[model samples]
Target chain A: MLVTCLPDVAKDVGANRILKTRAGHFHHPFGDPSRPEASERRWRLEATKKALEVLTEPVTEPTVFEY
Target chain B: MPTNKKIRVVHYVNQFFAGVGGEEKGDHPLTFREGPVGPGLLLQRLLGAEGEVAGTLFCGDNAYAADPGAEAAALDHIERLAPDLLVAGPAFNAGRYGLACARLCLAVKAGGKTAAVTGMYPENPGVSACRRQVHIVPTGDTAGGMGEALPKIVRLGLKLARGEELGPAQEEGYLPRGVRYNAFAEVPAAQRAVDMVLKKVRGEPFTSEFTFLGFDRVAPPAPLKGLKGKKIAVVTEAGMVPPGNPDRIPGSRASTHHWNKYSFGGRTELPKGSFICIHGGFNTVFVNEDPDRMLALDALKQLEREGVFEKLHEEFLSTCGNGGPVHVMKQVGQAMAKEARAAGVEGVVLPAT
Candidate 1:
């Protein structure tokens, strides 16, 4: 499984389980420099949880789980 | 080359095509005949006066599989026969037969004496095994396609024997070998670009000069039963490494050896200034400010503390994905998987940049 800002790229490459992060940009897929340190950490933790959640779901093809 | 010269051809076939018994005769040993046999007769007819099937070699699929020296033996016979061309089976979709045909053709080509060719279904396992190495004309899924397949095989085989330059896959009626050749185009590049753009704007069909090959689809492994007691690892193409970049992994187009594993033992987070991002594809400032942003090491450690999984693997694997070639990246992925599996890692979180 993988987390990427470009879910279409993941799908194109046939990644079976993907988490599409609501990232600020390619530079910071998991971090929001605009946000305060604590809030950014919280957001990162939530993203990680979503990524882990993607692993437990059954998938017949490349399926993206939005976070 | 003299037009009157007769091209000597050696035809290869499996037991079924050789009139040997089916299934049971699959264990039949290597055998040779003086003249065209079965499909070779059609091949010779197609060759007409330009070529002759000097010999036909037959082997059982099971025999080929059972003997490691099967290909060597065939090569020895082919060498002694000294045919200008070796035409292996239009094997269609028969897996074992297709593989034997493909492998033998590849060996024949590598011998640098006989030009070799084969035919099979586009989706045959043999196509993948040797398409890039040998001329494999695509055929129908079964022997029902033999009529159409043989003409193409003969055409390609004859051209190869005469040392003629082959056209593109589409024009030559063979599988794409994933090779590019330089050619003089009738149109200039700038005009062609404009023409393509105009066609797109007009919504007319226009073929692109380049074709992107389709990626191989891998079936998803079974989902983990649960994450509670699982041992997970963090991996990334975000190129996070120690501040000094000890391994000297390049900023772009990193090779297989550029990938490395760094231990996060006893560390709850990747401290700022201690690690940095080296990927050249994107801005690394944010990740450099806090390396945990790229690897999620801090969040993963928090999850570890919460028993989300039994433990976070001690080492995290990383490589610079920027401009890395697909072949090199594949090797890097395999190497990382090997290391992670050896460390008893059950799951991996790969954050891509």
Candidate 2:
């Protein structure tokens, strides 16, 4: 479960498609990737967490992406 | 007067109250043996001179909730001899027990006995579900309130037997079972609202004049014929680990939050030192120490490599054991499905919470 704080990385992964939500607990919509910010990472993390729970394998590790 | 033949009320209770095992007992369904057992004795003791529990029925919550066909068959086994009224555990807050009571009371009342069915309650969701059909009187939260509750319920039953016009719930001190009548009051909503406001302003007590709610239990589809070699994915509401502990996957719907995920890739086998938990909105605390124990990633990875199913999907979905809201959960589910589909995964195996 790669907890990407950015949409670019999350969207890049064919697996993180489930984390595509614009809303947060505070009832705020997360801006799209073009307008990326730190909070979007939380949403991406939330999505990643949920998606990863259903995975049948442990994520070996997350490699830092320069992009 | 031909003296009294006491009203025989049948009591139903789950395994816990019956002094049987808890969840384990509720796993079986509908069997009948004559005499009373379980909470039946306590109920009979409470009824004293007014009523006698004719019989008792016991079943597991899992069997009923998981398999209603078995539940119905079990009920058939219990209703061998009709009593004046059928009683199920007030259930307090136990969802399955409360539901069983509500359902039994409803079925008994419907079986053509003008019998005054009653259930004790402490606001189990089932109270709302079966309140309208049966005399599901409200009560305090535990068995401690049973004594005080019994007489009141019995009184309601007597009124039904005597054909006496029953007063409003508050007037009679019985829990409002939410039963409605056919007679329509002539007052319009405007007038009624005004009257209600006046009473409230005067600090006068008032009762809700109407109550009827819907209850639908959707049956689950049958399980796949055989799972001997299926590529099963175990999901739980158990918060696998502490928050921000690197976002481990979820385990239970009713459990708590924890983080426990670790990275995975070309591992041929799971590294030791990780565990899983059973969370049913009960408690949370497992993933804080390490991700390997829960998140079950290591297990899945090993299984995938071993050809557990065919190909293991990458990136499991997760959340706090708390009911992940529908909107976000569905989005996450769709994402997982997409991933699983890509990896050629099949049906999932949701661990029992």
Candidate 3:
């Protein structure tokens, strides 16, 4: 599973596995309806796609998403 | 039963608070002095004739944090003082000083002769790390709040020293440590609920009976080898339930401790008509259109078909993540992990909303 969160959070939590997304911790970030409809969709799809990529990568230690 | 003896109190502070040089003196070692110094003077005055400051303990924040032996040496000094109560900090926003105070409290308690108490900003890392183990009052973020904070800290310390029965954190003005026990209330639950509801309706502030303590950080386990044949499962805290909402988990502000489990044992994908999102924290429209928006069961099924993994754990653990208490969430997660391990599930993809 990919944890989509900020690098600071990844470090603060000291979690070895994370997909370091550029967002704050909490809730379905991409599911927020406050943003423009198209942008919201783009963010959701992009995050999900990134998570899938993270799922396939191999690493010996704690890894962060390149994106 | 009134004893004529005055209660002995020990006050602890950092070098800066003790009238020593600021950041530069932080490397200085621990020092012991007779009677109060700096803020301790105010605390001593607050104690009045009922209690006396037997000694003041001072250490540089850097010294305390840097020296691994500081805790033992400090405790040795405090134990020799033989004070009935230990008072540390009112540290305000100083993170290092706050942690120093917290560590001193723990060390004092370990000495076993006196009760220890301290105060710091609720947001202090010290508070998060040590709150569960000691009695800490919630103070303001800056030293400016000291006037208000010291009195509370001293008062609470006095109560503890005198062996007075203490009230809950809310009533006593300290940070809650997730401790709960049975006690009678002045009003019935129905009446209290109505009173709280009325206050909410009037837009007046009211405190809830149950408070949410923050979450704990769980470190990730070592990376697993090859996913080609590992058993994986997907879970969600987005309130996905079978179409009829069988478990009835609340859509938002769900029960702080309840987590429900659903089994999809042999299903290739979550059928379009079989599930729905009921999470009240956000708009559910996107998830309703495709339940996969939350857990991505269909995608997982596709990956499974493509042989990404040998098996998918059919059972899914779930809860409404939006507003669950941290302590309860930890317990639920622990239980879920234990069950997954027993079921031979190798990994989990937890999608949170």
Candidate 4:
């Protein structure tokens, strides 16, 4: 499983499970400097949790779970 | 002008096919014969009056595998015979024999003086190793398929020897070498694409002009029971590294060695100016301002304290994902997996750029 802003790339490359983070950009998939430090940390925590959640789901094909 | 001269051919076979001994004679040295031997007889008959099996070259499977000079010796014999084509074995599933045939054919093809062709099972290791460098006709897994395989090999060999423009793999009946040749299509690409899209929408069967080679699908491992006490590791291709770029991981096209492990044992967050992103594919300013954006080190540490997981792995694995070749990246991934497993890491979070 991987976290990426470019979910299409991950899906095209055949990643079985992927977490698509809306809050992140290509440069920083987990961080958004625009948000306050606490808010950014909270978003990152949620994103990481979503990535962890993705791993527990059974996937027959490349599937993107949005965060 | 088309010359009337018969297409002179040199045939290659292992000891077993050459009537030398079987596995025992696998160590037999390279030997040359004046005319067709064993399967070469069939190859010659298939060629009829258009080609001649001028000479035969045979070597032990082990001999070829053990002898680094085997290819040079074969080339010398081929040069002396001056054959227009070199037809190696329909080696089938014989690993060593298949490898030898593919390698010798690759050498002959590289010489440019003679065209070369061989046959092997599609799954033969040799096929993957040298398919792009040589022409390999697909055969069955064993010699039982020779009757069906030889005719195709002979046909392809003759065309290659005559310097003919061959068609695509499906049409030519050879393995796809992954090299694209430019050819005029009946319709423009834009029209073809539209037709394909319409066909797809209409649920009609249509063959796509271009086929994408897909990566092998790996079955996902069963997920960890829970993160409560599991040791999770953070891995990234974000190119985050300590100041000064200690390992000199390239900004792109990073090979296996470029991947490195770094210790973030006690750090709550990656402080500014302490770590930097060297990835060439994206602007690094945002990540450089706060490295945690790329690695999530701070969040992971906080989670660790909150009992989200037992403890964060002391070290995080990293490499620049920007433009890394697929093959090298595969090796890097394997190496990182091995490392994580050895360290008893239960789960990994790999954030990619």
How well does each candidate reproduce the native contacts, as fnat?
0.82, 0.00, 0.19, 0.68
The ten-residue window of minimal lDDT in model 3 chain B covers: B214-223
Better of 1 and 4 by TM-score: 1
RMSD of each: 3.2, 15.7, 10.7, 5.4
Off by over 4 Å in 2: A1-67, B1-3, B114-116, B120-122, B161-164, B173-353
TM-score ranking, high to low: 1, 4, 3, 2
Index of the highest-DockQ prediction: 1
Cα lDDT tens digits, model 1, B22-128, are: 99898888888998999888998999999999999999999998987777788888989999999999999999999999889988888899999999998788887
- lDDT by residue (B103-219, candidate 2, tens digit) is 776776677653655555545777666554566667777778777666666667666644567776667765565555466689987899889889999999976567433222222
Better of 3 and 4 by lDDT: 4
Docking class of 4: medium
Best by TM-score: 1
TM-score of chain A of each: 0.90, 0.32, 0.62, 0.95
Superposed Cα RMSD, model 1: 3.2
Docking class of 3: incorrect
Flag regions of model 3 displaced more than 4 Å. Answer: A1-48, A52-67, B1-4, B215-353
For each candidate, the alpha-carbon lDDT, in order, equals 0.88, 0.51, 0.74, 0.88
Judge candidate 4 at residue B131 and give its lDDT. Answer: 80
lDDT of 4 by residue, A7-62 (tens): 99988777878888898988888988889989999999888877766767787888
Q: Across residues B1-353, which tens digit of lDDT does each residue of candidate 3 receive?
A: 14346889988899888998889988989988999999989888888987899888888998899997777787888778888899998887789988998888887777677988999988887887678878899988987888898888878887877778889898898899878878999999999999999999999999889776754444456556767788887666667787778878887666545566787756655545567877777777666764655665655666677776777777787877666555555567777787788889887776665
